[model samples]
Target: TGTICTRTALLDSRATGMFMDLAFARENGLDVQLLTHPIFYNVDGTLNEMGSVCKEVEVILWIDDHSKQVVFSMIRLGKTKLIIGHTWLHHHNLEINWTTGKLTLTQCLSDC
Candidate 1:
């Protein structure tokens, strides 16, 4: 949709899929796509109080010198705006240095 914006994102190993805050997506004027199937729970099987997740957006995520188009499901996130979850980490073969707070992508799929 050519919408470009930057925001703090959480890299959560516990999360199963990428996510974007609903309000943030609206504020950035990102084009929202309706999900073919709505989501009703978190990956952990906990109930989501915000109801079903029916919207999503595709955006180019830039981290330092790397960039990739990612789809983030729209949901109500309390304080966090964006989340790069385990699916992305595993697909990219990401390595994280907990001591130094550094992230490295060791591999890329054929798409890259």
Candidate 2:
């Protein structure tokens, strides 16, 4: 249970779930849990033999004065660290401004 204090995150609307770098998770000393089922995907949608995903971790997302805890599945993404995907965005009712490259939390649910 480690708190993510980094502001640098990529907002990917096309991504279905949150993802974190395996190396980063290890460096942060985050507790990674094994998934019952493995997730497989490539950046180009081509099949690659990267084995199964056996790790996941919960991270705290801090934005401005608001904060939220989110679970991220660990993967080996080259050069990319944190990626906030559609699931998290929709769950939090977040609005993204493409023009200004800004993210706004439209509504806060009770859980959030």
In model 1, state the lDDT of residue 84. 88
Candidate 2 has a TM-score of 0.75
Cα error, candidate 2, residue 57 (Å)? 0.5
- Candidate with top TM-score is 1
TM-score of each: 0.83, 0.75
lDDT of 1 by residue, 6-110 (tens): 677899888888989999998889898998899888767888887789999988888766789889999989799998888888888877788988877666677
